[model samples]
Target chain A: MIGLYLTAPYLVYLVIVYAVPIIQGFRISVLDYVYAAPGASVPQPFVGLKNYRKALSDPLLRRSFLNILEFLAINVPLTVILGMTLAAVLAKLSRMKTFFRSAFFVPYVTASIAVIGVWYFLFSQGGLIDHVLGSWAPNPSWLVNSKLAMVVIALEVTWKQLGFYVLLYLAGVLLIPDSLYEAASIDGAGPVRQFRAITVPALRNITILVTTLALIVGANLFAEPYLLTGGGGPNGATMSPALLIYQKGVEQGEPGVGAAIGVLLTLFILLVAGAGAGARRLVQAREAA
Target chain B: MRNGQYGRTLRRLTTYGFVTLGALASIFPLYYMVVGSLQLRADSAFSGLIPKAGNLGLQNYRDVNKAISLLPSLGNSAIFTLGTVVLTIVVGLPAGYALARLRFPGKPAVAGGLILVLVLPFQVMMIPLYILAVRDYGLADNYLGMILPFAVNPAAVLIFRQFFISLPDELFDAAHIDGAGEVRTLLLVAAPLTKPAILTASVITFIGPWNEFLWPFLITKKHSMQPLAVSLGEYVSTNAATAANPYGVILAGACVLAVPVIALFLVAQRYFTSAALGSGVKE
Candidate 1:
C-alpha cells in the first residue's frame, strides 16, 4: 500500500534506533558486557540478571532512587499549584498580560547551562545570595550541604519547568467558558470562591495531563543536579537515578550495570504513569457517580 | 459603595504586586547572568543585585572566546541541530501523511507504538545507541551519529499527523484526479498547508539538540568535535579554575550558548504558542 511505502523510512528508523536499541539494551544488561574494555573483542557472555541484581543491591543506586521520590514529593505539588496560580492571575489581568507572560517564560526558553551558572553564582560562598542572607543563615554553602543541595535542585527544577506548565494551564484556562465565572459572580461568590468552584473543576483534565507530564519529567531529572553538584554532592545526597546510571555505566565503565539501571528506571516510569492514569480514571468515575 | 470600590481597588493592586514579584523571580537569574558576565573579575560578586554602570566590560566574553574552542563547538551545534530538523521533517512528514491519509496495514499498531515510544525515556535506549554509534559503526565524533537518533522524533511525527488528519480529503483527491502522484501531491499540496506544523516541529526539534548535553557528550569524545552544550559543560566544570575570573568567564560561556536559543524563541514566539494551540496539542 502507498501508506506502507510512505511509512517505511520512519519505521526502519524506529526499528533501528529506538525499538532495536531498547531490545538490545536488555540483551546487553543480561550479559557481562563491557564494550569499551581492553581486548573485549569477543561477544559478551550471558550473565542472566546478575547485573540487575547488583544494581538493585547498590547502596548508591538505592540512595538515588530515594532522592527521586523526595524530589517528586516536593516538586509535583509546587509546580502544579504555582503554575495554576500564575495562569489564573495572568488570565484575569487586563494590562501587561503579555509582558508578564513573556517574563515568566524566559527561564523555560533559556538553556540549563546558563540558568545553572546564574544559580551557582547566586548560591556560592560570598556570592549575592550569601551576601544578602549571611546574617540570618551565615553563609549557606548550598552545593555542599546534603539536604539543602537536594532542596535547591528541586527549586531549580521547579523554576525551570514552571513556564511550560503555565502555558499548559493557560491553554486549559482559556477553554473554560467565561459564563461559568459570570454565573458564579452573580451568586455573590467572591474571586476566591469563584476560582475554587469554577476554575479547579474546569481544569480537571489539564491538571491530570500536567501532573503526569511533571512526574515523567521529574523522574528524568538529570541536567540540573549534574550541572549544579557535579553529578553528586557530599554523601550522594543530590544524586538522581539518571545521573547514577550515567556515572556507573558511562563514567565508571560498567555498561552492564548501567543498562540494568536504565531498564529499572524505565519500569519505574511505566509504573508511575500507569498508577497516575488509573487514579485519574477512578477520580473521574467517582465524580460521574 | 465607596468602601466596596476601595476594597476592589486594593485587591487589584495586590494581584498586580504578586504577579510582578513572581515575574521578577523568574527573570532575575538571567539578568544576573548577563550583568555578572559583563563585570570586571574583582567586581563580579561584590556588586549589588543591580549591576554597576562603570565596571561593565566585554573582557570576560573575549577571554571565554579565546579560552574555549567556541566557534568550532558552535558550528558543530549548528550542524547537529540543523541536520536533526531537516531529517525530522523529511522522514516524519511522509509517515505522518501516511497515517493521516493513506490506508495501510498495521496502522493501529504503528500509532500505538508511537505513543508507547513517547512514554519511554531515551535513557532506556541510550546504552545500545552508544555502543552502536560508537563501536559497531564507528560514528563516534561524527555529526551523523549525534543527529540520527534524535532526527526520528516522535513528537514531530505526532504534530504533523495531527495537522494532516484535519485536512479535507477532497484536496488530495483533486490532486490525484489531475494525475499527480502521491509524492508530488504531498510536496506541492499537503505539506504547504502545514506551515504552522512545520514551525512548531522545527522550533521544538531545534531546542532539544541545541541545548542537548548528555547524548552529545556521550557521542563526541574529542573536545574540538563537541557541541556547545557539551563543551560549555566541560569548560564550566573543569576549566573554571583556569580562568582569571571564573564567574565572569563561565557566565559569559553560558551567554554564548544561550543567546541563539533565546533569539530563536523570540523570533518564533507568536508561532510557538498559537501553532501548538491551532494543532489542538496542549503544549
Candidate 2:
C-alpha cells in the first residue's frame, strides 16, 4: 500500500535511532565494554550484570539517585503549589491575562543554557540574590556550597518550568463551572473556603497530572545539573543519573557501565511514570463516578 | 454591605499583589540578563536590577564575538535546527497522513509502536546513539552527526497523525473519489488544513533542538563545530567559573542563545497556547 511507503521513513528512523539502540544498550550493559576506538583489537567479554552490580554499589551513581530524591522533594511540591496557586490567581484576573501569561511563560521558552547563566549570576557570591539576602547567604556561594547547590538547581528547574505547568493548571481551573463558586459564596463561604472546597477538588486530576509530569521530568534532571552545576559539582551533590550516563558512557567511553546506569534509570522512570499513568486512570474513574 | 465591600477590596488587592509579584519574579531575570549583557563592569556581576545608561556598552558583546565567535555558532545552530525541523516534517508528515487516512497493513503496528515509544525518554538511548554517532558511524565533529539523532521525531509524527485524523473522513474520501493521487491530495487538499499542526510541530521541534546543548556538545570536539548553546555551556563551566568571570560576556552569549526562541515565542505565541504546549510536551 501507498501507506506503507509513506510511513516507512519514520518506522525506519525509529528502528535505527530508538529500537536498535535500546537493544544495543541492553547488550552493552551486560558486557565488559571496551574503551577502544572502532575496529580496535579489544575483547568485550560478557560480564553478565557486573556493571549493574558495580553501578548499584558505585558511590556517585548511588548519590545521583539520592540527589534526585532531594531534587524531587524540593521541586515537586514547589512546582505544584506554585503552579496551581498562580493559576488560581491568573483565573481571577480579568485584565492583563495575556501579559501575565506571557510573563510567566517566557522563561519556559528560553534555553536552559541561556537562563542557567542568569541563575549562575543571580546565585553567585555577592550577586543580586546574595546581596539581597545580605549575610544570610551561604559561604562559598550557592554554586560552590555542597548543601545549597542542589537546592539552587531545584529552584531553577521549578522557576523555568513552573510557567508551563501553571498554564496546564489554568486550563484545568477554567473548566470548573462558575456556578460551583457562586453556590459556595451564597452559602457564606469566602474566597478561601470556595477554593478549598470547589476549586481544589475540581482540579484534583490536574494536580496529579502536574505532579507526575514534574516527577517524570525531575527524574531525568540533566541540563540544570549539567550546565548549572558544571556537570554535577560541589562534591557530587548535584550529580544526576542522566549526567552520569553521559560521563560514564560518552565522556569516559565505558559503554557497559554507562548502559547499566542508563538501563536502571530507564526502569526507574518507566516504573514511576507507569504508576502515575495508572493513578491518572484511577482518578478519572473516580471523577466519572 | 460595608463589610462585604471591605472584603471585596481586600481580595482584589491580594490577587493583584500575588500576580504582580509572581510576574515580576518570572520576567525580571530576562530583563536583567539583557541589562547584564550591555554593561561594562570590572567584576562582571549584575550592575544592579536596573541598567544605567552610563554603564552600558557593546563591549561585552564584542568580547563574546572574540571569545566564542557568535556568528558561526549561530549559523551552526540555525543549520542544526533547520535540518532537524525540515527532516522531521518531511518524514513525519507523509507518515502521519498515511497512518491517519490510508489502509496500511502495518497501521495498527505503527500506532502500537508509537504508544510504546511515547514515554521512551531519549536518556534511555543516549549511550548507544552516542556510540552510533561517534564510533560506529564516524560522525563525530560532523554537522550531519550532530543533527542525525534528532532528525526524526516520534512526537512530530504523532502530532501530525492526530491532527490529520481529526479532520473529517469525508474530505479525504472525496479526494480519493476524485482520483487525485495521494501525494496531490496531501499537497492541495489535506495539506492546507494542516497549517496549525505544521506550525505547532515546527515551533515545538524548533525549541527542543534550538535549546539543546548536551548531544551536540558530545558530537563535536571542536569549538568551531559547536552550536550556540554548547559553546556557551562550555564557556560557563570553564572560563565563567574562574576569578576572571566575565559576567557581561556570559550574559551576552546567553542573549545570543536565548533571543531567537524568545522572539519566536513573542511572534507566534498564539500557536503556543496551552493546547499546543500539552501536545508539545511529548517531545
The sequence of per-residue lDDT tens digits that candidate 1 reaches over residues B14-76 is 899989999999988888888888887535344455667777799998888888778988999
Residue A46, candidate 1: alpha-carbon lDDT: 94
Top candidate on lDDT is 2
lDDT, candidate 2, A85-166, per-residue tens: 8999999998999999999999999999889878878887788887777778779889889999999998888899888888
Runs with alpha carbons beyond 4 Å of true place in candidate 2:
A39-41, A186-188, A274-289, B2-6, B42-47, B241-245, B281-283
- Computed on C-alphas against the true complex, the DockQ of each candidate is 0.61, 0.65
TM-score of chain B of each: 0.90, 0.89
Give the Cα lDDT of each candidate. Answer: 0.82, 0.83
TM agreement with the true structure for every prediction? 0.94, 0.92
> Which candidate leads in DockQ?
2
**Residue B165 accuracy (lDDT) in model 2:** 77
Candidate 1, residue A242: the lDDT equals: 80
Native-structure RMSD, model 1: 2.4
